[model samples]
Target: MKIFRRLLSYLEPYRIFLIVSLGAATISTLVALGPPYLVKLLIDQVLIQKNLPLLNYIILGLIALYLLHSGLTTLRIIYVNKVQQGLIFDLRNEVHHHLQRLSLSYFEKRQSGRITSRVINDVETLQAIVSSGAVIFTIALVTLLGSLIILMRLNLKLTLLAMIPMPAITFLVVMFSKKAHRRYRQMRRRLADINAILQENILGIQVTKSFRREKLREEKFIHKGEGYYQANMSVIRIWSVFFPLIMFASALGTVIVLYYGGREVIAGNLSIGGLVAFVSYLGLFYAPINQLNEVNNIFQHGRAAGERIFEVVDTIPEKEKKKAIIPPSFLKGKVEFDKVSFTYEKGKKQKEVLHQVSFTANPGDLIAFVGASGSGKSTIVSLLPRFYEINSGSIRIDGYNVKDFKLGYLRENIGMVLQEPFLFDGTVIQNILFGRPGASKEEVVKAAKIANAHNFIRQLPEDYETEVGERGVKLSVGEKQRITIARVMLKNPPILILDEATSSVDSEAEILIQEALEYLMKGKTSFVIAHRLSTIRNATRILVVLEGKIVEEGTHQELLEKESVYSHFYQMQFKENGKIIAI
Candidate 1:
C-alpha cells in the first residue's frame, strides 16, 4: 500500500487528469454491468410475461448502455495514459535530482548498472501497472460486486450454489500471488545481473580486446543472459499452472449454476427466462474473477520494481557534501586538515583505515604528499574536495571549515587532475569547456596553449573540434593527460590537486607536460600526490603520508638532508628510474 501511494504521489501535480480518469472508470464499470442485467430483465419481465413493446424498449436500452460503456472506457484509458506519462516524467526527474544531490561515496558503494536499471526499467514497469493493470483491477471489483448484488436478488439458492467454487478460487489466487511475487523478484534480480554484464563489458571493451579475452567475455555474457531466460521461464511455468487453474475455477461456478438452475426450471419452481437471467449474472460474476487474477500478476511485478527503485530514491544522500549551497565567487582556497581521520568502516569500530592526521596549506603554496600504495595519499587529497568526510576531525578552507561551508563552493574553487583522466565523447573544445562553462573561445585557446595541447589539437583534422571518443580513447595517453591539464587550467581556481598527473605518457611527453604543470602550479595553492619524486622538486613543502598520518614533513632540501622516510623514498625512486628527481 505504501509503495502504491508513493507511486501515486508522483501524479500529485496532475490531479485534475486523475480525477477525470476516476470518474470515467466509475461510469465505465457501471455501464459495462448493464448488458447482463438487461439480459436478465429481458428474460424475466419482457419474454416470460409476453410484454412485446417492453422487450423493444429494453433492447434499445441495452444498445445505449453498451455504447456508453465503450465511450467512457475509451476516455478513461486516454486520461489514465496522460496521468501515467506525467507520473513517469515526474518520478524520473525526482530520482535524477536525488542522485545528483548524493555524495560521491554513495556512487562508490553502489553499482552504476543497478542504479541505471532502476531509473530506466523500473519506471517503465510502474508506468504499465498504473496505465492498464490498476484500472482493470478497479473495474473487476466493481463488476464483481454489481453482478453479485443483482444475482442474489434474483434467486438466493442458485447464487449460493454458484459461489461454492469462489473460496477455492480465492485460495488458489492467494497461493499464486505468493509464488508470482517470489518469481518476479528473481526475474528482476536476473535482469539486473544482465545489465551489469552489459555495462561492464561495453565500458571495458578496450581492455577485453587488448588482452584477447573476447571468448571469455562472450561466455560470461551468455551466462548472464541464460540466467535471465531461466528466471522468465520459471515465472512462465508458474503462470501456466495457476492461470489455467483460475479459468477452471470460474468454469466450475457455471457448471454448478446450470445443474441446479436447470432442475429448478424443469420442476416449474423457476421459469426458462428466469434461469436464463441467472446464467447471465453468474457468468458476469466469474468473468471479473478471471480479470482480477490477471491484475495480481501486474501487482506482483510492479511491487518488485517499486522496491528496487525505492531503495535508491529513499536513501539519504551522503553527509560529506550535504552542506549548504555556496556561491562560486566567495571561495578563496587555503586548505587545512585539522586532525582529520577517516576510516572505511565495517560494522561500528571493528575495522578502520585512517588514524588522526593533520596538515595545512596556505594560498599560492605547492604542497607535495608522497607515499606508497594504500598509505592513504589519495585519501588525504580526496578529503579537501569533500569526497569523503572526516570521522573525527574537520577540513577547512580559508579559516571556514569545509563541513560548515557550502559543498559547491569548496569543490568549485578546487581544481583537480586525477591519475586516470576522463574525457567525455565530444570535441576537445567541449571537454575543456566543461571545466569553465562560460569560458570564451580565446580563453579556451589560451589555456590549451599553456597546457601544451594547442599544438597537437591544431594538427588534428578537425583541430579543437576533434572528437575525443569514449573516455578519450581516440587520443594517446599523453594527449588525454594534456587535455585534462588544459581543462583545469581553464578553470583557474585558487587551489589545485594533481593526483599522479604525470604518471602516464612517454619520457619526452613527461618533460613537455612537466613544463605545463609548472605553469599551472604558479601562484595557486597546490597539492601533488605522486610516487615519482621528479614532479615535486619545486614544491614549497613535502609531506610523507603513511597509514593515514603525516609521518614526516619538511622542504625537499631539508628532507634530503634528514635520511628519514622522505630520503629513503627519494633514493628508491632515483634507483628505479636512474635519475635523482628533486636534486
Candidate 2:
C-alpha cells in the first residue's frame, strides 16, 4: 500500500485532470441506470395499459440518455489517458536523472539490463492501472451501489435473495489476488534475469565467437527463457482457476433471484414488470462486482512494478557537497597524496588494495608509475580523481584537499586516456567535441593535428563526419586511441593521467601516440602508468609499486644505480627484448 501511494504521488501535479475524469465517469455510471428503469416503465405503462400517446416520449428519453452516456464516456477516456501518460512521463524522467547522479560502484554491482528494465519495462506495467483501472473501479463501485438501491425499492425480499453469493465472491477475489501478486512479482524478476543475460551476451559477442562458444551461449539463453515461460505459466494457472470460480459464485446469485421472484409473481405479491426490472438491476449489480475483481488484478500487477521502480529511485545517490569549494579556472596541477589507503570488498571480507601509498608531483613534472598487474598502479591515480573515497589519509591538489573541491570542478581539470578507448556511436567530429562541447571547429582540427589524427581523418570518405559504429567499431584500435588522445587534447586539462595508452597499438601507431603524449604532457603535472619501461626512460621521476606499496623511486639513472626494484624491472624487460644492459 505504501508503494501504491508513492506511485500515485506522481499524479499530484495533474490532479485537475484526474478530477475531471472522475466526474465524467460518475455521470456515465448514473446515466447507465436509466435504461433498466425505462424498460420497466415501457412494460408497465405502454404495453399493458395500451397507452399510445406516452410511447414517443419514453422512446425519446431513452435515446437521449444513451447519447449523453456516449459523450461522457468519450470525455472520460481522453482525460484518463492524459493523466496516465503524464504521470508515466514524469516518473521516467526522474528515475533516469537520478541514475545519472549515482557513483560508478553502483553500476559495477548491477547489470545494465536490470537497471534499464526498471526505467522502461516496470514503469510501462503501471499503464493499465493509471489509464483505466482506477476510474473504472470507481465507476463500478458507484454503479453497484446505485443498482442495489433500485433493486431493494422494486422488491426487498428478492434483493436479499440475490445477494446470497456476495460473501463467497468477495472471498474468491481476495484469495486469487494474493496469489496473483506473488506470481506477478516472480515473473518481473525472471524477466529482468533474461534481460541481463541478453545484454551480457550482446556486449561480449566478440569474445564468445572467438572462443566458439555460440552453442553454449544459446543454451544459456534458452535456460533463462524456460524460466520466464514457467513463471508466466504460474500466473496463467492461477487465472484459469480464479475466473471460473468467480463466475460460478456470481451466477449463483441470479439463480437465487429467479427462484424466489417467480413465486412472488405467481402469488401476485410482485407485478410482472417489477420482477423483470429487479432481474435487470441484479445483473447490473453483479457486472460491477466482477469488473472490480478484474481491476484488483491490475492494481496488484502495478503495485509489484511500482516496488521495483521506487527501489532504484529511493537509493541514496553519490554525495555532492553543495557548499564545496570551486577550483580556480586555470589550475597549477601540483598533486600530493599523504599516506592513502583503500580496500575493495571481497564477499564478506575487505581486501586492502593500497597501503599507505604516498607520492608528490610538482607542476610540469612527468611522473611515471611502473608495476606488475594488480600492483595498485592504476588505483593510485584513480584516487587523485576521487573515483573512490580513500579509507585513510588525504589527496590534495595545489594545497586544497580533493574532498573540499566540488566533484565537477575537480574532474574538469583532469584528463584521462585509458588503454581501451571508448567512443560513442556518432560522427568522428562529435566524439572529438565531446571533451569540450563548445570548442570551435579550428580548435578541434588543431587538437586532431597535435594527436596526428588529422591526416587519416581527411583520407576517409566523409572526413570528420564519418559515423563511428558502436564503441567506435568502425575504427581500428590505433585510430580509436588517437581519437581519444585528440579528445583529451581538446580538453587541455592542467593534469593528465595516461594508463598504458600505447600498450595495445602497433609500433607506428605507438610513435604517433608518443609524439602526441609529449605535446600533451608539456607544462602539466602528468601521471603515466606505463607497461613498457622503455617509454618512461625520460620521465622526470619514476615510482615502482609492488604489493600496493612504493618499493623504489628515482630518476632513470638514479634508480639503476640503486639496483633496487626499478633496476630489477628494467633488467627483466631488457632481457625479454634481447637488449644487453649493465645494472
The candidate scoring highest on TM-score is 2
Instruction: Please list the residue runs of candidate 1 whose C-alpha ends up more than 4 Å from where it truly belongs after superposition.
Output: 40-63, 320-329, 346-351, 471-473, 575-583
Off by over 4 Å in 2: 471-473, 575-583
User: Where does candidate 1 clash, by residue pair?
Assistant: none
lDDT of 2 by residue, 1-583 (tens): 8976886788888899999999999999999998988888888888999888788988999999999999999999999989988888988888898888787777888999889888888888876787768897989998999999998888888888888898999899999888999988998898888898999999999999999999999999999889989999998898889888888888898998888888988988987778888889888999988788889888888888888988888887876677798667788999999999887553446788999998899998999987778889898998888888788989999999998888888889999999998888898999999889999999999999998899999987789988885844378888888899999999999999999898888888888988888888888899998765565787899888888998888898998897587678577765487222222
TM-score per candidate, chains pooled = 0.91, 0.94
Q: Note the Cα lDDT for every prediction shown.
A: 0.82, 0.86
Best by lDDT: 2
Q: Candidate 1 on 140-197: residue-level lDDT in tens?
A: 8887898899889889999999988888899989999989988898888888888888
